[model samples]
Target chain A: MLDFSILINNLDTYLEGFKNTVLASIIALIGSFIIGVIVAVMRIAPIKPLNWIGSAYVEFIRNIPLLIIAFFFYIGLPSIGVTLSGFVAGTIALAIYTASFIAEAIRAGIQAVPKGQMEAARSSGLTYLQAMRIIILPQAIKIVIPPIGNQFINLVKNSAILGMIAGLDLMYFGDLVSSHTFVTFPVYIFVAMFYLVLTIPLSLGVGYLEKRLARSH
Target chain B: MFKSKTSKIAGVLLLSASMLLSACGKGDKETSGTAAKNALEQIKSKDKIVIGVKYDTRLFGLKNPSTGDVEGFDIDISKELAKDLLGDAKKVEFKEVTSKTRIPMLNNGDIDAIVATMTISEERKKEVDFSDVYFDAGQSLLVKKGSAIKGLEDLKKGTKVLAVKGSTSAINIRQKAPDTTVLEFENYTEAFTALKAGQGDALTTDDSILYGMADQDSNYELVGGTFTDEPYGIAVKKGNKELVDAINSALKKMKENGKYDEIHKKWIKSH
Candidate 1:
């Protein structure tokens, strides 16, 4: 049976989980975007060492599972005396892991801009940095919007990993409710609905922004 | 391209919607089917009993890495039950179950009975049937040696106690020590690992399980001798009265014959 009673009974628990999930996702989204941009720029920058570091970071993080990264922060870090709560560790791991993929998306976006645009900007008395700041990045942002939006959506769903580490996110509370009630199916169905509540708007916002960018161009 | 992307999104939406509707439909059919044949007859017809047990808890049913076998007091009891039912000790299959998954697995008929180190509580009795207590464990704390926390009274505000999610210990600690923060993990291994890594001040669970952890690593020892009694029982699906009765009789016979004491001595007393 489609049970609404489980959801109604555990409304406060679900809401607490919802709030933590939202907080974790927002913090991670902003953190990953900023880190992603910096790493993307470093990969494309003129300096050789910076490019190596950027590639190393992206390749290392992207290759390993996000769960291991989260575990490292949760269980591995405390051995050397750096202890972080589950929420803090899970959020940091989310940001760190997602940044690699976001970096790749941005790098591809930056490269998609025609080489002639950069040359033209530089030839017109704009410095390389100025040409990049004004012409290259703006165009790259437009190109990267869809992929970055995709990453953001993935990040929101992936925040469920926090639950495994006792981060008190939506999926964690979902487990709690299901375990307490032994009503497995409905609890997760409701949890999925909560995630959709965050992601559908994100998907629509991306579509809207894509359209607006196309119009401006 | 945009049109294709929109269509893909629409396809995903449709797929998820259908999945949600079909899941409920399937669940209804499964529950209805459970009414026809009880689990005892089904197990007898199959000739092999499937048991759910923990592959992580050391003194209970831990999977030995070198031997590639689950060896513990619980596994021995399950084997004896298999022998009693099908005339062969090996006529049983073990499916690993955690604190979170055992009840669901039992109710889903994935396993006929759960012999995991599961505590019997009134809340759980509504969903499943429990046999007489096979092991009398009590909730206790595991702290690193030489720590200031020696007992439950020492767990003041700002103290963090780690427990497995979906466990009675988690609920009990939250009630008994309301001021201390409780951190729950997916399983005992992770909780113990977290404690070793200094993530929590102490880890709380059944004293039997804590004994397993301490036996594994001498650095950690049991503190706070038993705050609550955790009577572990083999769980079967609710309404499976025949299966419950069969298990209860089997346990009674084991106790009468001293097989139960032998198992306890082998796994518990030695440690």
Candidate 2:
């Protein structure tokens, strides 16, 4: 039979792991949002070089596996005299990987906004930057809220990859505990529950926001 | 509308609760059957022995990437056992096993015996029976050649030690150096690679495995003689006294004939 006592006995270890997972997710979330906005702007920019750079970054990152990216930061970087703690390296990889998807989502959102909005603002003497800032981005963000929410949820789940690099995330500690105790099935059940604790609320919040946004529209 | 939303939440909660209940209900059922005849008698009739050994861990049982042949001290011992039993060393089959898979594979009869570099512990003895200790190993540390970290004592707050997940070394290091951060990789190779990449100050595992790493890379050296005594034993299914006795005698004969020394010298001494 599955024993809940192992979980109760080592509740502190699981909580510590959960804390790391949450921390990594929050940092990646904020960092990816900033990077995503910039890349989205660059993709929509009038300049040819900016658009190419933005497109290249999104395509290149989105194509590679998250594990490879995490390895590159965790293993590859140290060879070049750049050393980062596992937590830092994992956060950077997660943020960079998630940013690519966020950029694509925001780009789609930007395109969904009617072209007339941009033209109307430009005709009123707003600079291209001002027109994008004041007229286009706010509406584009609203259109992207659902997808952005989806990405955030994915980011939380994907953070499990950090466990591979010994980033001390929930999955890492779960593996350690399961192997030590040899209660593989229950340890994972507990891990899944911890992940659900983070994800279910985020999902519900997203649904609430989506409903509110839909009603306002 | 709010009532509908509340019902939806309740539905999800109910569904998850049922799933959890079902999972808990499906308790592990012990497989029972008529006591099979001794394993030695079965092996002789079948004309072969299936042994599970690690395909990683350099000196212990790593597979050569080029030839696909597993070569290590553990491999040699399994072959010796096969020769002693079946009159031919080649009458043995080697299956790859990791630390995590070894016990389940043995319990389920996926493999007849496990000759992997498995450490015998009191807790594990409940699940499986072990032959007399074939090799003595101990938990030790591997550090870069020029590292200032000398041993486990040097591991303090801010010191990062790399080890493989699910390994006793990982657990031992955590208890030994509670303040020191331990980062576990999936295997010794990965942990050693991390050490080379400057991810950790030292890598902790069995000295036998560490010797293998040091053999492969001149830049690393084994530091701090073994801290924990880790005896390697060949494990068979629990309560298999006949098989255990046969293995113990085979091991004794090998030692008496000086074959054990030769194999140990060939692998362990050279490194």
Candidate 3:
């Protein structure tokens, strides 16, 4: 059995870390999904400028490491007169970085859907937006959910970067507690379990949705 | 009947979860020395004083990697104070704190007092009370021991100074060398590492912390005298006169009885 007396003794501090991690992940998850969806759509848009803009965003963010993206947002943006809290910076950077991947996944899914779907919707008098919203998107969403879920799990793990800026997230707490307690292994194992507590369910939920979406398909 | 039982179970689970959440935060803040003493009384009236400390700082404090026990100068001071306050020095709890969150942790009643080589500054005084300067330190630069950089004045134009964000050193560097770029890192070790890795020409922080790094690596040394005074002090919550008085009295006694000097020599001078 794992010796957890130290963990039990310091459970309160770890819980604070857990709260910070969960909150940061949730915020990043929502923000990234929104950004991913928007950019994914733009990447396939008809207009030349819009397509280039989206392509640039996706490529630029996708190439950089998440930490660099975070620092860029945390430090770089401040130079241009925008300031953000560590949480916001971390969450936004996590979202934007992961969004590139999410956008790629979603774009792949949309492309996998037949051009016939868009064509059929257009022939039936639906606008491009309407076709994307009602017809093409539903199938694309189902196809992209699992990969997007993977990106989300990564996002949750990546939330730790916020601590570099003192975001007070779970990873920050972990770093703080472990450095203080000098028990990095057990502290991390506890944090890993906490992450599993959030992500395991997500994985299961994704698996379930993947199956159900397959069935409906 | 099933619904009632289910609801009862849910209620109990909720209570337990909340208990775990509050358990970590349940300790009361001691502003005046009395609250700290009362709280100490509440716990040590049962037996144990949990003192939050820093484990990253060398000479001042550090966690021994092998034993997983934090030990250093500040730790020794707290231990001695515990002996005076609780009648048994061993009945103490240690928590780690960083510069940014140390004050918040103290304010939130997480630890009784912070003995983390905290610098006494005017801005910090608004939130917490300080015992007299227990450790004399100031903002200074640490570089590779053989480096030619003598002091802040000697740095070439466009020199980079590594410092942690929100640190007084960062503000100090900007003031002293407005044209230089200051690369802010998260903590002491990173800044030091950055200096070693050639990310920056010099690392700036309290000399005590720099000494900690120096103790670990001979290649690096404090390059200049403290450019700004950064007197270290023991911190307690603002308005906690009881705990404050007990700590200050204990500190005064520690200094008078030569326990302070003995501790100083043992952790600092002996090294």
In terms of DockQ, the best-performing candidate is 2
For residue A114, give model 1's deviation from the true position in Å. Answer: 0.9
lDDT of each: 0.91, 0.90, 0.78
- TM-score on alpha carbons, each prediction: 0.89, 0.87, 0.58
DockQ of each: 0.59, 0.60, 0.07
lDDT of 2 by residue, A1-217 (tens): 7688988988998999999999999999999999998998899999999999999999999999999999999889989989887788999999999999999999999999899989999999999999888988888878899989999999999999988888999998998888888678889999999999999999999999999888877
Deviation in Å, model 2, residue A42 alpha carbon: 1.8
Q: Runs in model 3 with CA error above 4 Å?
A: A1-100, A103-217, B1-46
Q: Scoring model 3 with DockQ, what do you get?
A: 0.07
Q: How would you class the docking of model 2?
A: medium
| Tens digit per residue, CA lDDT, model 1, A163-190 | 9898989998888887667677889999
**Of the candidates numbered 1 and 2, which has the greater lDDT value?**
1
Q: What is the TM-score of chain A alone in each candidate?
A: 0.95, 0.97, 0.91
* Candidate that would win on TM-score: 1
The candidate with the higher DockQ, 1 or 3, is 1
Query: Following a full C-alpha superposition, what root-mean-square deviation does model 2 have from the true structure?
Result: 7.3
lDDT of 1 at B162: 94
**lDDT at residue B108 of model 3 (Cα atoms):** 70
Residue-by-residue lDDT tens digits, candidate 3, A1-217 = 5659757887886787678778888878888888998898888988888888889999988998888887766666755667665677778888888889998999999999999889999999999999999999888888898898888878877887877755666666666556444445787788778778888988888888778888988
lDDT of 2 by residue, B1-271 (tens): 9999999999999999999887655522212221456666777877899999988888779999999999999999999999998999999999988877888888876678999888998878888999999999999999988888988889999998998877788889989999998888877667877899899999998999999989989999998898999999999998888889999999999999999999999899964
